[model samples]
Target: MTDTGREEVVREEVARAEEELRAAAALLTAGIPRVAVTRAYFAVFHMARAVLYAAGYEPRTHEGVLHLLSLHFVKPGKLAVAHGRVLARLHKYRGEADYGDSFVIDEPAAAEDLVAARDLCERLRALLPDESNRRE
Candidate 1:
């Protein structure tokens, strides 16, 4: 993709990330911890994709996203290792919350996931070029 097209994709992914964070917060507030955990994970996932796209990489799977992020950003010191750990934790929680019939997430854990997602999103957003500096 051209730079402009890539930037557009980054913008869309970032927007989706923010939206998912908001939904996660709302769901937690509404007392739905399981779904909230899932939303929080997606928030981080989309932010990871945005960061990858900004760096000219496109991952086709969840594990691929994590691997690319670690290889391209975390390993190179662009992002903290904790970010990778949090993403992995959130991914695990998301899977349990979504598919594990006996798994349950408490309110506090869900809230923690939201906080972690927000932090990850902020860190990933920092890696992108400023929107105002991009050409229309």
Candidate 2:
């Protein structure tokens, strides 16, 4: 693709990520703990994907984002560490939520996960400048 195509993809990802962030925030406030935790994963995924998109890289799945972050060579920070651990929990939770009988994630656990996820999202947001002046 051309330079124009890359820029467009980045813009699209930024828009989608910001929307996900807003949805995550709403879910957090509305007491939908499970949905909030899941959307928080999406929020962080999109936020990280936006950065990769701008750098001319293909994006990954939500779980892939977490896996990549877990690698020590990439963006070593507290957020990344938290993202890795939370991602492991999310992977298990997703599997249980889909296929396990009598398995569930409680509100307290979801609430705790949401906080970690939100913190990771915030760290990603801080890494990028606002949309209006995002010329990188």
- Where does candidate 1 stray beyond 4 Å? 132-136
Candidate 1, residues 20-133, lDDT tens digits: the string is 998999999999999998999999999899889988998999999999999999999999999999999999988887788888878997888789889988888888878812
- Candidate 2 similarity to native, TM-score: 0.66
Name the best candidate (by lDDT). 1
User: What lDDT score is found at residue 39 in candidate 1?
Assistant: 93
Candidate 1 clashing pairs? Answer: none
Per-residue error for 76 in candidate 1, Å, reads 1.2
Q: Using TM-score as the measure, which candidate wins?
A: 1
TM-score of each: 0.93, 0.66
For residues 33-114, what per-residue lDDT tens digits would candidate 2 score against the true structure? Answer: 6666566666556666655555455645666555555553155663455555665676566556556775655677776776
Candidate 2's displacement at residue 124, Å, is 2.0
Cα lDDT for residue 89, candidate 1: 93
Model 2 scores a C-alpha lDDT of: 0.61
Worst 10 residues of 1 by lDDT: 127-136
